[model samples]
Target: MNSRRATIADVAREAGVSPSTASVVFSGKTPVSDATRARVLDAAAALGYTGPDPLAASLRRGRSGIVGVLQRGPLGIAFTDPVQRTTMDGLADAVASVDASLLLLRPVPGGPAGDSGTAPGPATGAATLATVPLDAAVLIGTIPEAAADVAALRARGVPVVVIEGDAGEGVPRIGLDNHDAERCLAEHVRRLGHTDVAIVTLRSELNVTHDRLGGARDVFPDAPAFATLASSIDEGLRVGRQVFAAGRPTAVLAQSDLLAAGVIRAAEEAGLSVPGDVSVAGFDGVPVDGLAPYELTTMVQPAVEKGRAAGAAVVAMLLGEQPASVTFTSVFRAGNTTGPVPESRGVSPR
Candidate 1:
């Protein structure tokens, strides 16, 4: 009667069934006689009725049935970051196993130009990322600038969980032992009699300008350093050039294997060899892409398992379980990248 297009009412009228019966044919919530269901479905097919409007059903149920997921970086970065990818996979597995879904919401906190939600924005992040309705929200990474959004979610009584980063207070946290992991790598290089070590680093946070190596320096001030913001490979190559231009390090402990591999490449380019001219080490225990024969001395974290744990935690939270925290450990892998500092160092890189 409310003229727009065919609705459940129209289908019910055509099938000579009550509106509730028509809904049952679509949702299968209540049992309908087979013959009656067939009649309702056939009438629906005739009227080109797809099904009940999900919005309407959601409103009726008083739940959106969606979990909002917030990320600080592009989705592609999620794939590249082994930890994030594994965690997401775990979350997805849990959601699927439970017949639930996750809705991605990336909030550009500056309102496209740092305006704070004034300009036109996409439906997902604009509203949902900031104040959209959700049963719960998982801040995939920390967004310090989006503090208001975090506060809003809390005000709405939506449970929040953070993976790999913090989301203010009163929210559940799932984190890796980043400090310990870095310390472990540092200790490995230090124990090898190499005090003159340079580091290749990753972005510290969403700001992207905060030097990861600088932070490391604050923690390990005496550690010699050449830091880069590029991926492990890029950092390796950049630092490798510096090595060739400035001088050689007794050992180089890169932040990641991708960077370590780049260091190896640069070492070879500079007519130096790994473990021969310079002992190299890296983080993330995952295998290198083109490093065929050489194994990297790095810390390996159970990425997928961490994700699964986070997902399970989310499930527990959804079931009204008390919020808790989880931390995963990193296993050090003895590989070909590191060895005793070469007895003969021509000159230390100043």
Candidate 2:
């Protein structure tokens, strides 16, 4: 007999069982008797037949069992941020429950930094959204490219969920009360008699950053503001030095804990004391690796919860359920980094 590719029917015939039984033996969607399973396996081995092709199986089900996580920058650099790491942990936990795997997708070159909402032109890898098979996608942050990415995914009939960024209509968002949280932090400092302040912020292109900045400015309108490209400690250090270059403010409000830690380092290098000479406050209540002997006064946000909500939304969309957008609040945490404004500055408390 001429050699030919073996099919499930061939195996079923050799095993003296129906094709459906043979299929169940491989798919595991239905239980088969031990004797029948053994027979099917023996028949498959004798016929040189492997299990059913994944692509064909997926085609039959109309689902790739893959979830795409659209990130703003290189995965390595993006994962360095503690908030991102924590958020991803929550997302992974939720995605795993649906028996789906995550595919980290990066935008093409010339895109904004990892945390901004601006979208890039195209992806750098062989798999673009237009070509990759994805059951759904989650936008990690607001990027200018978000609207375009959403359009592409929607065109492919893939549902999209956004975390901390606006993707426009019909897209569910997992958001934080950034403005109120920052305002609360601002109020804390204002009550401490801090009038002269400097603000260090993440990329202003992101709505989260914009809202946080706006909240602080609402309380201290004359405060000088510096925007950093990425939410790394190094960027924080650079901006911290600049904030103190001309003149020192009584307090500095950094948009992230890492940035606040960097500002503390800058203050020490400049021979200024933290909280004693210049108070400092930050957002995101995450631990700063090298910030020792000083705890940051910050707004503690539920980073993991934000990610979990996004993941849950993805699962819901995949199930044909419309999940409502969720908004989370942040809690204020007082630490050693902030204190009452120095009384000897010759400036009176507000």
Candidate 3:
């Protein structure tokens, strides 16, 4: 055996088959006979030929076979959000259909600081969409810096798909009916007779937050709104404490389930029972790990479907097909967390 790496040709020669036949066994694009595939596998094992070189194959096809998923914040934080995880799962399935992998790209400072014009290595600096080899990019959330990220990717001729955010004209968006869905939820709360309501938001900069806030306000125009830095339960707890510290409302409308769970915790700590002292409603129907006892009242958005839509759009754009933008609606779910406003509260029932 030679010290050099084995190629498909080596396997073909050893298996007594044409190179194309040997390649077909690996590609799976064209079917090969079971007997011939077995021979090729045996030959590959004997020659220590693992499989095809993805880089070389991608080069031949003029594609990197990589799609960048731009996270609104740190990768660790993104994974903590159930909605993000569910959406990514759907995105993964969609991208896998097209045989592409996802590369997480985080926002960083301006391009590499030198004359080279090449993106700095990941170790030296955060990877920007400009520096990464992405055939297309999916903007996960509406961060304040999203405009610049979209511009950079578009400048490089990469297709962009936005999930729950606006990336300007020409960028196809997979959006949720945040305003309408949230308004529906708010109306439910209002009918339940919750006039004094407080809103807990994910982040101030997110478009989803803005839409949800707008919806809640549409019902309770003067509702006190508190913004959290992240979508984590801890952030929710932090904001929940503040909102509940002084003259807490009869109900709290949290932007995400995690936030609602945190608010529930805070309410308990403040010696208030959920739906007894303060009714809580949340958006995003994701399950919280520790929130077992209380089934959260929330608007169940199709998070995974949202991701699939974005992934499909990416594939379509890559293939030069013009895919239309997608808008998804949320289903209202009734849970024990929300109920008719406590009669003891001074506010009169509508």
> Which candidate tops TM-score?
3
Assess each prediction's global lDDT (C-alpha) against the native.
0.70, 0.86, 0.86
Task: Report how far off residue 222 is in candidate 2 (Å).
Answer: 1.6
| Tens digits of lDDT, candidate 3, 1-350 | 45898999999999999999999999898988899999999999999999999889888989999999877556875577788888999999999977899988775544443221235554665566777778898887666557677777788999989998888899998999999888988998898888889999877877898998998889889988899998878887888999989677899999998889899999998999998899998899988889878999999999999999999999999999978999999999999998888887745566
Which residues of candidate 3, in runs, are more than 4 Å off? 1-3, 31-35, 110-126
What are the per-residue Cα lDDT tens digits for candidate 1 across 95-142?
A: 665455777666564465342222236453455454566777777657
- Which pairs clash in the backbone of model 2? 117-142, 117-143, 117-144, 118-143, 118-144, 118-145, 119-144, 119-145
Superposed by TM-score, candidate 2 places the C-alpha of residue 253 at a distance from the truth, in angstroms, of 0.4
Please estimate how well model 2 matches the true structure, expressed as its whole-model Cα lDDT: 0.86
* Alpha-carbon deviation at 246 in model 3, angstroms: 2.3
TM-score of 3: 0.90
Candidate 1's C-alpha lDDT?
0.70
